[model samples]
Target: MADKEQFFSNVYDVVAAYESGFVGAYGNPEAAEALRDQIKSAGGIPDGAMACSTYKLEETGKGKLSLPFLEILKLYPDCLPGGAQGRGDCVSWSSRNAALGTMCCEITSGIPDPNSGRLEGAPEVTTTARLNGVLSTEAIYNWRRHGGDGWSCAEAAQVLLNDSGLWLRKKYDEIDVDFTQYSARNAGLYGSRTPPESWRKIGENHRVQTVTEVEEFEALRDLLANGYCVSSCGSEGFSAERDANGVSKRKGGWAHALAYLAVDDRDEIKKLYSEPLVLIQNSWGAWNDGSRRIFGTNIDIPVGAFWARWSDIKNRYMVAISGVNGWPPKKLKSYGARGFI
Candidate 1:
């Protein structure tokens, strides 16, 4: 409890300096533990699950998958995922919107740049268009957020799995309700209280099936290298806006939830930063667009997104991989594919 207070105090101090009015509430250590117990009981993540650590791409059949970077933005180019607009509904935005959308894109479109000479994803579901757009941030946030102040990534995962199920923009018709497209006002307005019951049930088809707790680097990379996406919430803040490399400077404060949509593990990037970079998508709408190509790669640093080093985030960042409904999709060949590494 003492640590949690100190954590929020630091957040107030750090973000207070910036004019972006960025509010950070990633839930403290105490909140995480309580949520973890609840998550396990709800069957979100198993008692002893080791998914990515045990995942292996068939050595002989799939061939060498050379990934200079795992770019999710390349898969789904809605760089600005609507925006949090100072709301604490980041868990909803990151979990359902960025993470789930990108994973669905991968499953439908295959790797952005498959240098492995094969398209690997569920091509059978290519006709499914609803999974391609931005989900309703308020639908989940309205139900799971703790009074619009904060919510953990795990809690958001639970919301996606069982509680409220998935709900996309009314345009996508992810649910029965005519939940209009997302906006800063609607997210803030409806999310201030519980949502109507009619907006709860996930579309009969689109639902997150499995949630895996991933605390290790190898595990994160393994899942990302495939077609899955990971969401995270941690107690940390950036000192300044993103630099030329698109890397946000760590300020050592803030409880914030965000998503890791891509990974930049290029040798050149690692050599310069001393570790790989994780492409983070923030809920803040176009909050920071200052970026440059660290190397000769077409990795688009979206408006609301930035990059962070693995060394800096490995310890404090808590993440969970959300596997979509269509698991183990077909591996289409990327013979003439355009993979953005």
Candidate 2:
């Protein structure tokens, strides 16, 4: 209990500091270091605070194939490739989830042979072919334009997944759409163009279940254990932080969508912290590539993926989208209030 209380207090202090004119520090390494020193001097952080590191198969001795859901990645490693380039942000991130979900369905139900002529009612089509279709930032950005900026993570994920067959199957070069022009034409809506009323229609086209109230740790573990990825949205945690010159800095809060790939076993992670850690893949390209290495050893997070504590996720995560093979189960229906339809 003392450990939990101390962790919460530390989080509160850090969030308060960031909200109270220390915002720039979050994007500046030198400034963040100075702020950390000040916090230490003020005794804000308690002794014996738990520390967690990003999940790495090698470091944890847990191979990706050991987890059934992640095994698909071995056959289709590029299914969740990174490179949002600030264009897609949450939209692209959610699209990655939708894509991964589709791939999982293919793996579980078996991919339809392109020459089988059974594409009409097939459970899933070619995984790589589908990935090739939606991998473009411009393609996803054009679909379901909500506001001038970007759609909420849920809105984007729902639309992209539901309409994936029509949009996600086409190659990038085959489509000639300009996201900049699309955003300019459809500016200031503040919500998804598809709207909540259209969810039923959307679901008719795709097999996905959106849950607003997840059991946090257990739900995520179960979903991953079943060979599925969860698409999540939250206003906390940092995917990437950089300064004016594009130098990576300290990690901080951001409203974003990410694909929850896997979590380290509770037994192994409990060795370092009071809670287990989850592995998430980000749309942001490699963390160490180019000018993005400023995060340094302070956060041992890798490029495109990182480990987040379960406590933080429980507190800040808002929703999760799990792909289903047939009709969504009855247990998931209780969490239906989260669906867009």
Give the best candidate by lDDT. 1
Could you give candidate 2's per-residue lDDT for residues 209-231 as a string of tens digits? 32222344554555454444565
Per-residue lDDT for 51-150 in model 1, tens only? 5434452221121222312343344344344533344456677776544544555455654323233333432212122333345566666655444445
Among the numbered candidates, top TM-score falls to 1
TM-score of 2: 0.51
For candidate 1, the C-alpha RMSD (Å) to the true structure equals: 8.3
Q: What's the lDDT of the predicted structure labeled candidate 1?
A: 0.54
Alpha-carbon shift of residue 234 in model 1 (angstroms)? 1.3
TM-score for every candidate vs. truth?
0.69, 0.51
Q: For all the candidates, what are their Cα RMSDs to the real structure?
A: 8.3, 16.7
Question: Cα lDDT of model 2 overall?
Answer: 0.40
Candidate 1, number of clashes? 11
Off by over 4 Å in 2: 1-69, 105-140, 160-166, 172-215, 239-250, 288-303, 324-341
Please give the lDDT score at residue 30 for candidate 1.
62
